[model samples]
Target: MPINSYDYYPLSWYPDSTRIKRPKYEAIITLLEEDIVSGVLKANTKLPSQRELADYLDINFTTVTRAYKLGVEKGLLYTNIGSGTFVSSNAFKSITISTDNSPAASIDLGLVSSFEQCNALLVPAIQKVAGQQTITQFLNYQAPTGTAFQKEIAIRWLSTLGVQTIPERLSIVSGVQNGLAIVLSALFSYGDRIVVDFYTYSNFIELAKLFHLTLIPISADLEGMSAIELEKICQLQEVKGIFLMPSCNNPTGSILSASRKKELISIIKAYQLIVIEDDIHAFLTAPFLADYSPPIYQSLPEQTVYLYGMTKFICSGLRVAYLVFPERFKNTLNRSMFNINVKTSSLDSEIITEVLHSGLAQQLLETKKALSQEANALFNTIFDCQEVTGHHPWPYFRCLPIPKHYSREYIETYFNQLGVNVYHSDRFVVKSDYEKAFIRVALSSSSSLEVLETGLLKIKEGLVGLE
Candidate 1:
């Protein structure tokens, strides 16, 4: 096999030749599976030889061989000694293909462009860091906790979160998702009750489901999660822990107030509940805000699990989010992670640290603020309809309430047809709700004001039609 042959063959070539818009091997498998299931290729029907198929399809022999293997795996075909592959007897039973042609869509709400810009600015710094003779330190297995410099940089970054902690309390993980997984794995078992805000980060819901943790949704207001409700739930159930996004809470764009934070802390202390503070969107808050603290548990450090993702503010591609354990839980969390992933990539840590120290993070944040303001302005202008209200001009996203009669699915479909994407209220819901009331329009850092305005106009047109 030529080294560059497969690499050189454009993905478009195979699909074009086959008159199949799907991936080459996937299409071949689909065709074979269909034939077998329909009895056009009977149970005992011998498949064309790889070379024959290759010639017939005007493609490479290797492609046909791969397709056959895939078909065999799907029980559509089987091979016997000295005989060619034949359709399996149970081929029809295994021929289930999902025909879900759901539209491919995404909401342009995240401010990850700032992260990308920071990453671009840090490339040289990263190269310089790697060029150091100490680069060998990263090549070998890194410490379970992370390197000293990495820890130092992480601590400095954590300070920005208003948590003044030593490296001992922090363990660097692959990313926020990994950190959440590790924390969940260490703290809770199946059927354990974990409390979360009604409108919380969607991924946390997924993580809770994966771990089989019972997610008890706490009610919330503009100041953030209801401390009283949380207290009630903690008392009623043996709530193992609480997962919260205290600062610039996602989807809702609500910031938990300082007084509310204190109250929540007191309640957690009373209930002795472990708190997982996902401050991923912490840095986006105006630094001067008196109530804003990057890590919510800076005061009650012990019972709090502080998760800070550098990716959200600094660089998303870095895949770095530290879990600052309350001093007592550090050893246990470290051990749990080691037993699973062994250690996170030292290279990523080094790169992230280099970027942080280079002042690129600050520059990126400034740019983000400016871009967010512009995007928000565009959002306001585009959705100026009387029905479209409740949009707080936050630099990141605006929440608009839908009419009682309108379904989120219908709105999403309408926007998608116009090449605009909007997140349905259900994306933020911890528990299912029949009424699709709110739609979140994120002012993405990547999108220009003109582009955003165009998208928003389409949304307005869609809503107008609905009205």
Candidate 2:
């Protein structure tokens, strides 16, 4: 192996030989990360072959392999099946939804706002809950799965969205994200594969990484995620579950139709995949669309954990949502809920119950819907929208497709520099090979109507010569 040092070829990365630490693998990752963060190695740059790197460094090939594996796990790199390993598309960018780092007057078009204008509508309910004689009941440490009264309210709140579920089968979690954590922790083992749409909620993507779950990215059509692709993936590998936002998918606003649901259900049944239905936005869309497909949970109740989030519609600060699961998984879900969340605040649950009971929740939904309409209309005036699902009730975010020339990295930083904080499509991507790109602009995030309008217009001006 030491036959010829003269035959060595140049590497994409030239690490300083003297700088590598004793344990070469960790040092390799450190230097690789340093190079990536410093911008010396750009996104999607293919790295040297593992064997070639090992030979160049005069170390065992397994060390380089371990280093490359660690790099992928760290989100600093990704590998295409046949193609060699390369830097992750999101390696150079920091994914976040906060404006803490943005300069003053920065219009936030990143975080999906719940249209905070509707929060004022909940004041009466909060006051009513505070005045009740039984207010101290919520302070008790009992009812980890919510009190009977709270579950009754959950049933009533769910009924509005056409969901039929009894108190025994339902659990009140803090939010959809919380329910998701319980499901993943209680059900799935590490390294389990789950299928997802090409582009999805960025938070979910990070959550999967945290749990070490492999996400098999599937292609999407006019109707959400494709069934044909699901079949192909199932045939190739074992997928434990699937995550879907069938009713108004986040970031893209794609909705799955009835016929398409049947197609996917067949695949789910054949594969026996646990369906994690995030119907968080159904309340906003179902009332408007007469022909909206019913939640998949209804068809496969035995194999689904349906989450209905009230954050975007009622009150985001309350951090309240509901989850309905089958009786078979009750023990595991309950145990995980107890371990992860000692209890989802009964105080927050009570206020939400009062809101639902007093009919303020309906008023809040209507007001939020009206605000959503105004925001969508404002977005339409500035940019052209290609309708994804039929009779689409504009979701909180809009996808603005861009030319290939507008790299995802540039779109993010450039937008922030122009006083707008938006996210590139790559932020929501799982493992897509699609060439098209876009940025997801949160229409409902701004403080007032005028602020949203100003942000959208700023984006239009920024695309002057790029488009």
Candidate 3:
């Protein structure tokens, strides 16, 4: 066969020439697996010619040929004698399931670095405290409620959001989800009514369903859930409470406007309803917007519970989230915590406190802001998405409508093929007639500009292809 005519050249053809160290055969196989899993190596895509792959990887031609055979044996690739090697249709599905059983690889994109990077500084400071005689207190079982110092940090963090609260009034939970679960358990009996925006966090919907709570979808304008509609629903239904993401709402990324917040607060207060505010994405916004408080906090009666997760901004592994309750609900929340898990993790609390004290918290925040800015710029360029009115990149969840005929899933699949991960709008919709054929790109995770640009270009190519 003529070398020029051969089409089964392996992906090794695109190797970086300056990389003098040859990748192990296993590493090469893993690379191919990732390409397949991410959708880069699409189903039925043909491998390059063995000679071409060898030249690309700067390895012996036999090595390329052997690697191709190995991939086939592993069921990642298939070959016909004359037709050439093609990616197996089920390659990624198998890999996805196997990944669950295997030890995690080093480059898991789902992993976020803000908290991990913060803990690198925190661990030493904590060790210094551990060296003290009183450190033994940390190992022993103690109060179901957090210590005064932990509460202080929680208060300080909340203060940044313009919420004022005392230690006695707060209950430190295992994490935001735990806190959410407890609130759901406490507030709603099975089949109670709850209202949320049409495109709110899916977790809220899942939780409501799990708890047997009836969820009502509230209509939303560009400013977020409409106050008039929310009031009308509350008057009509026996709503126990409402779950909301008033700031940088998940999936849709709509920031509830100040006026909308005020209207919601007044309506909820007049109806004497419970409000569960999920402010997980609050800190990701620009610093200038830090002081913006949810109207629910200011306008609602004392029964409202405001929840904030340090995990999203810090690290998911930390698993620490604090909730500020109305003064009357402190006893009730504390009892719920004791009944559920007895207490939050003191070790996690200490580590988080160290991060806050070491100034790394602020540094990470700054780093995140910068990263978000760069990612947003890259996203805008790649999609050529005219910023929809009221879209802000750093703190807001930005949605780009998928071009006609292109489903959000197709865009997701296309990006996955290019080694990029992203979410579609359907991930956030609860109950509504709204069409969700849009991409919801999150900029919270730290990524290199080069990687961002490469991913964006691939997305742009996919979008252009749709046109």
Backbone clashes in model 3, listed as residue pairs: 8-47, 8-48, 8-49, 9-48, 9-49, 10-48, 38-416, 39-417, 40-417, 253-397
Model 2 segments more than 4 A misplaced: 1-76, 79-83, 89-96, 384-391, 432-434
Tens digit per residue, CA lDDT, model 3, 1-467: 23343245335235333443444454566577666666677777888777776666656777777667656534467787898877765354321111243223222222223424334545565686667676766665784567788788778877777677887778878888889988888767755677887776756666664665666777788878888998888776677788888777766667788777878877887888889988877776535464465436655638679888877777767788888888787767777777887778887777777767677778768766666666677667766755554434554235656754554457656666656565555545442224556665544443456654665566566656666
Q: List the residue pairs that clash in candidate 1.
A: none
TM-score of 1: 0.72
| Per-model CA lDDT versus the true structure | 0.68, 0.82, 0.65
User: Which candidate number maximizes TM-score?
Assistant: 2
Tens digits of per-residue lDDT for model 1, 370-431: 66766776666666633221223353666777775654457667677766667666656544
Ranking by TM-score: 2, 1, 3
**In terms of TM-score, which candidate is stronger, 1 or 3?**
1
Q: Which tens-of-lDDT digit does each residue in 22-95 have in candidate 2?
A: 67877887788789878889988999888877877777889989889767745678888888999987666655
> Which predicted model would earn the best lDDT?
2
Query: Which window of 10 residues has the lowest lDDT sum in candidate 1?
Result: 93-102
